[model samples]
Target chain A: MSVEVEVNENDLAEMVEQVWESYLDPEGINPLIPTYDENQPSEVHSSVSISGSWTGHIVYACSIEAARRAAAAFLAMEPDEVSQEDLSDVLGELANIVGGNVKAMLPPGAFLSLPQVVLAPESTARFPNTERISGVYGIWDGEPVSISMWHSRADNNQEDGA
Target chain B: MTLSQPEFAFVSTLVRKEASIVLAPGKEYLVEARLIPVARAVGAANVNEFLAELQRRPNPAHQRKIIDALTTNETSWFRDREPFAALTDVILPELIKSRATTRKVRFWSGASSSGQEAYSLAITLQEALPSGWNYEIVGTDISTEMVKRAETAEYSQVEVNRGLPASQLVQYFERAGAHWRVTSQLRKNVSFKLMNLTAPLPAMQPFDVIFMRNVLIYFDVATKRTVLQNVAKLLRPDGWLFLGAAETTIGIDDNYERVAAGRTSAYRVRTGVPAGASRRG
Candidate 1:
């Protein structure tokens, strides 16, 4: 059965902090005081699904520049040398790491999907049957980044029964 | 660059059929990006042009290159730091004691990319077991290039920095110009092979421990079931199976039971017909 515990923005903020410190930039990661502006551009997006006892989606949205920088750090290459594939790969992995940690916090037995990276400019992701549970905004080297969780409505209905 | 719907569907079908890896719809960027180099290698101007060529005549060599490029994974020594802890603290000690009569132990690093995992097992077992113990470490992956790299036992500076600590790096590796090669001692007990997890495996001895970390996430339910069935055959009755921390055997296979060791856990094949041991969909 899915764990009915609520995941708030602060929880997501903490998770993002740990991931960035461990994998990306330690010194540059900080929680943004306020959530990102709706108008802020999100040039690249990455996501992963967690299925099993609990089914949900974890999404990471960042500007192209931010993604390129993250990819450079992950691949240990210069920013100029980072290809679109490198960007997608690194961002996808970042989402995978965060998604895996988020799953760990939930009910056990939930399985993570391989990350999916979307490269369209100024794009956002939404699931029809899921509602936003938490959304955290942060800045990495002055670029806006966001992480959000969505829980399937079916899981919520089952929670009501429990 | 984003992949068009037709292109996304095309690569998705090909990747799934070829590797049993599900590339969902939104991963269009990955499909295009992964294929771009393959496109360039074959002298195509762009991904569209390359797709056109692939459509005209699906070259096996180009297909292999595409699969290899798309199959890349990020790994490091002691990744997640839990399974290794479970290994040294719980699994290894138990195996060594139980196998004292044979003085022999074997490990299978399923989906071992670039050999870090197989070598990690060798590193831990080197100190955990007695000097004269017979230990075998076999690493396998579907990518032929990764198999070759694993055979070489070489890693770049970036890879070494990922999860390897400074002390172990210096202790277990020697400089090989631009890269570091696993010490002869570390590579001595390890072997690499090319094996696709989705397909049936060849004849092999039962293993005492299997590191099936991080790969099953890409497989569908039936593939996961098939892989687990095969693993049941390969693993001895008392053997340990370590999956990625995010993965579990709950719904996919019912023959295994979770065994906790501190913060991490190991799964053991249930013996004696467990109460709810019947496999379920």
Candidate 2:
């Protein structure tokens, strides 16, 4: 008895804003403006999977400079003091948070998987058997950060009912 | 630009007068990091402009925001894994044995920020304690904003993602629109209030366990001693006290002695103190 969950571009925008305000910045002033740049290269990438009611993947990719600055703010340290491990952890956590929220919108029984991180320079993640459904791209602290949702197409006959 | 000496001093002084939290010189970066966004929110270009405006004319609402911003520490479910382990493995087993006659237990979360710690305790009791056993948890914080948020008992996904395992979440919480709310089964056993540790405390029932962790770092030496003294008054003579890994009662208070509890250490009133010595009803 699983129903469709509608997640539009606006939904993605709002989810990113909520995550940033709650964790990365308390004051909620550092807003992320929506942008469009698919080919933008990122130094760090992370993702999480959703299963059960609806199946999909939520991907979070950001430039190294952006990752470092975010880690610094999160730990309340200087940007230069941020280590590569810290950057990876922060990015992975962000993806988990965003993915967890998106999972909540779907029907009951949806479960979010553990977050995974890829640390190669100028790297991007690709999820097999899934197509990019919707995404939000934005500039945070003058660096690129993107959150995109992909739907699994394992069963072509199933309607993308949302 | 960074926060100037005058700006930092202004914020530090205000925070001290209001909340009694000392912001030392090295904390300039912290002030800037926290207050810069606040400044922008109030229409100021930067921290400097925000302080200048506040100095020219004080606004209680604006100042309250500053205090909340600085005092709002990051919190997560079962934050710092070892402490919760201590609760589950060491502290509760001992307490359950001692309270066999009463079949009840009480806990106090002295610095519960947004109610995670208190709820976590409730969930633990639900899963660990035997049937027919009853428990209660009281959460107190100095910030009014935090107290209100705690009372709501709702948390965003980002808030819950921090250190909360998915299994515990699905079992203890139910979805509320876009957020999650604590199940009434757990919520009924927990309550939250606004109280300042640096100030005189109100009458309260003695607790079997007191979690006053990670908050002593904000207070000066004298204030820390006083807070511990206040807590000791409300704790049963043999009750357990858990402080942050970095905090201790060895040098601050002599009434308590530290003992090992699995991966962490807990404090209990020193020997020679009569049983129920400080227990108030």
Candidate 3:
């Protein structure tokens, strides 16, 4: 099965919108143009992997300023009081929620892995032999947040795409 | 715009009387968070005004809405994976054998919010049970809105995401516009009812498995004990009971003896003793 055809950017956008509306702020997220601005790499990046019917990763990234405000809103705290660990957790949960919805669109039996968070000044997290198949770029509470789906090329070669 | 102490107290008392859910002092944020939308929906100026209006008029339907608002339906499919894993790995095998003569098993999703837990049980049994075997699931919630939502079996994208495995989503649910609707196969044997656990339970058949997960935290010790006792009345002698991870019958009820079921714990009615016989003495 072509992973790109099965799950695409529009599916990712809807999942992101749902997570934002349910947890963070209702109707606060709006889809951005489907283009990446590599000059402003997100300070924090979080991702969760899917294994089984499809193998890949869903990554969420956002600026540090945005992360603090989002974390505060999620934890019901003031933005200044949000900690580094809180930012990591909130981003990880966002990735997990988006990942889970995306996983549902895939073939049956896809297992979602625990969320992994990266706190860095740049987009440093990498997945070897994986290609980005689909992505959704959106703005939430004025912060640029994006979710991307990566399909593992190694898994593609190794397993029969049953 | 903020929920004041009196408004909070009023809501807490109303909810306690209506649904037996205790809204403690610090949960002002919870009340505010859950009720702001309710306030907006009803065209109240704010949560404070909503409470004022509720007290002034004393409308049963509006009071029911307040109770429903306070009682959070925070549930997901196969929430807390170990319990479901245990059902497949340990409990079902035993129940299948014990009920071999009848070839039927019944389940109760006690405190089933929006029917995820109940549907989860249906999916579990559908996959695990042998051919020619039959099953039934009855889900109950105090909130009329939730019961209706559960009966509909239509869930939003976010609702379906939580704790639901992808394979089951593909197998059991079909897309209805933007939302996902649980397929007829999963809904056929399952039904939801508007019943309060703290109140006298409606007449129902004894169930082989009863899941009262993640709901006891909202009650005080006495209410918990009473609810557990009431639940015990409907559970078969050899049936299984799954409470939330943090909840237990150890101090509250003596009739239940805990049994380790796979990675989680399940309670069984102690053999060699009459049902509801307290072992505390």
TM-score for each of the candidates: 0.54, 0.63, 0.59
| Among all candidates shown, the one with the greatest lDDT | 2
TM-score of chain A of 3: 0.83
Give me the candidate number with maximum TM-score: 2
- Which regions of candidate 2 are displaced past 4 Å? A1-14, A18-30, A33-103, A108-162, B5-33, B37-46, B49-73, B274-281
Prediction 2 global C-alpha lDDT: 0.82
What docking grade applies to model 3?
incorrect
Candidates in descending DockQ order: 2, 3, 1
State which candidate, 1 or 2, has the greater lDDT: 2
lDDT tens digits by residue: candidate 2, A40-138: 667788899887778888999888898898889888999999998898889889999889878878776777889988885433236777777788888
Query: Whose DockQ is higher: candidate 1's or candidate 2's?
Result: 2
Per model, how much of the real contact set is kept? 0.00, 0.16, 0.11
> Per-residue lDDT for B1-281 in model 1, tens only?
56778877877777677666788777776677667777887799998888778879865456656666666445678777888888888887888789989999999999887788888788788878877887899999877878999999877555777788798888898865445799998788899999987678887998998999866666667777888877878888888888876678888898888999657888888987542234653
Q: What is the interface RMSD of each candidate, in Å?
A: 16.2, 4.3, 6.7
Off by over 4 Å in 3: A1-162, B4-33, B38-46, B49-73, B277-281
| Tens-digit lDDT track of model 1 for A1-162 | 234744566567766766675667643323244455544567788889987768889988888888998888888889899999899998899899878767766654678889888886434335667766777776666887878787877764222222
